[model samples]
Target: MEITIISAQGLKKLSFFTHNLQPFIQLTTTPPGAHRSHVYTTTVDHEGGVNPTWGDKFDLSNIIDPSEFFYNKCSCIYLYLYTNRVLLGPRLLGWCGIPVADFVDGMASVGTVRWLSYRLRKKDGSKGHGVVNVMVKLDSSVFRKKGGSDVRWLPEVNVGRVAIGIPVRTLPVVNYIIYYKTIK
Candidate 1:
């Protein structure tokens, strides 16, 4: 998948009193706790404009294995904006969740670029401070379904052994123990 961040609108200031500000996107193509090698970031917009144009495109592949498990469970792409301050640390500006599957199907049917506008949201899913506009296209040439499952709902378990010992003289021993080792 090729994701292009065309622009953004209504970026919030880091503080009401300060004038210096910078902004950028910290983008990820998968839900939380997934792999991170697919993350894409843009350079900070140093002009301090409320609306910034990135015009940056990123390729997303191998973020999730194209298997039944991931295909069924995977949902959205996350976009987070931050303020790159000179003296102060980066501040979270806002976030947005893009439903990739919903748009990808339509893009495939039309075989054309898809443009979308996602309302920025806070971590709590309330309306945030901005809106992001993007263009995306799936590179069918790089798409492939590697035959394997990326996840297992239920894991295998190992069960075995027990040992019991009683007190002897002035020494105390293992009262009870279960010992087991997983087999390959």
Candidate 2:
């Protein structure tokens, strides 16, 4: 399988930060009910300046066109990105499979995500992972393509975009259903 690495720095080096990751305010997945927290709502300053308008991360626009990406010079492929923080997970950017128009049944997934939420740590020191709600805010990035299977993985892009919201996995919790829409 061929892979493509989309970068603002250079086609060769993917390490150098070139200011391309933008954050968009929306959710990747929403079960029956999940709170809409203002996780991301900011703009990016490309000049490498300190103190951004909203946060350190820039709001990334969701890319639906597979044409914008070039992989192995030829073969078309779907694109998705994940942040260093994989606690949240990956999201679908674009692919040649199914168009997004047919997607979006209810709470449509908008962008890619890699949540940084503070999930429970493991006693064995491995990594406690699950959809458990805690008193503290999760250091999450957000994920896309929850109920659907359109999700892709693009580790080439270090950090991508995500529409902020709770994962559909945590929908069963009574607290989630009660405070999904009210909080904004």
Candidate 3:
């Protein structure tokens, strides 16, 4: 399986003294109650400076177990965004984790780019200063081929423009929301 870190927006500056926050992503799987998991990272975005853009693509052929991940038992992918500074060292900006099963269920088609926004959390799980916007693409290799599966998600809609009466051609922005309900 492969995933791409397309770009990031609305990043907060960690240090006021230096505007040079070199950011990169650390991808790993966090199985519930597990002590450790496999991790990978993209090259630091040094050129784009703050709010850097890295079209980095990484493959997780060795990271996950096929049997466990397929069953949605231990398939969480944790993404941690960090800034590697020269003097101050690495600082955690925020982190978010999504279930690999979320995509494997065909919620998103192959080659589709989903703009996901996750809340920034510190090492202690407290709120951070900024929100990270990431454009992610799961490679086609993960999708099952030639299946008669029905799409469970709704049709793509430009909700932002629809509510404000803006034409779809003029504004092609979409807002996605996920709701959670506890089942006893």
Candidate 4:
């Protein structure tokens, strides 16, 4: 599975007097029955402050076993938000868990790209200040034969079931915008 840490919004500063929050995100995934989790991180966004965007992509195909990580009900992708402070080191802002079941349907949909948002939570599991957005898709190679030629599955667009929600109207709309591009 491929996961992208797209962006975060409305983050709260750790200190009352702090003006700038240099935010970054850490993604951790632990397969069911595994003793240790694999961790990946995005670069710190110095200018975004309250709202940061990082198009960092992590490929779990090599690190995790698909059968164990995807089918296990207890598996979760943990997201931790932190602020980098030169003198004090990194401080945890908040964290959230994205259950594998949430996107398992999209993965089964065969190359479907799913967009999701999750609210951050404090260490005690209370509601935190920010929301994190991510894009997820299962690699097509996972569904094919090992010795056969690589086959890429194209995403099916279901126009009848699509609903457009316009929260903001100031921006110009582009028809049939392509959201995902395969690298390599």
Best by lDDT: 4
Residues 1-184 of candidate 4 have per-residue lDDT tens digits of: 7889999999988778888999999888843234645678899999999899999999878765654565566668888899999889998899888876676654544667899899999877899999999998777654544466665332322323335886665878788966998999
- For all candidates, the clash counts are 0, 22, 0, 0
Off by over 4 Å in 4: 31-36, 144-184
lDDT (10s digit) by residue, model 2, range 1-184: 1111212111111136623333112222121124433222223223312211223232222322232321112221121112221344432221121112212212123242222222222323343332111111111122223344454432233122456987766555455445446665
Report the poorest 10 consecutive residues by lDDT, candidate 3: 153-162
Q: What are the Cα lDDT values of the candidates?
A: 0.68, 0.24, 0.64, 0.78
Candidate 3 segments exceeding 4 Å error:
31-37, 105-115, 133-184
Residue 178 lDDT, candidate 4, scale 0-100 = 69
Candidate 3 backbone collisions, by pair? none
lDDT tens readout by residue for model 3, 30-119? 632346567778889987665677777777757654434645434567878888978668877777776554445434665765656666
Candidate order by lDDT, decreasing, is 4, 1, 3, 2
Superposed by TM-score, candidate 2 places the C-alpha of residue 68 at a distance from the truth, in angstroms, of 41
All predictions: root-mean-square deviation over Cα? 14.9, 20.6, 12.5, 14.5
TM-score of model number 2? 0.15
Candidate that beats the other on lDDT, 1 or 2, i.e. the better one: 1
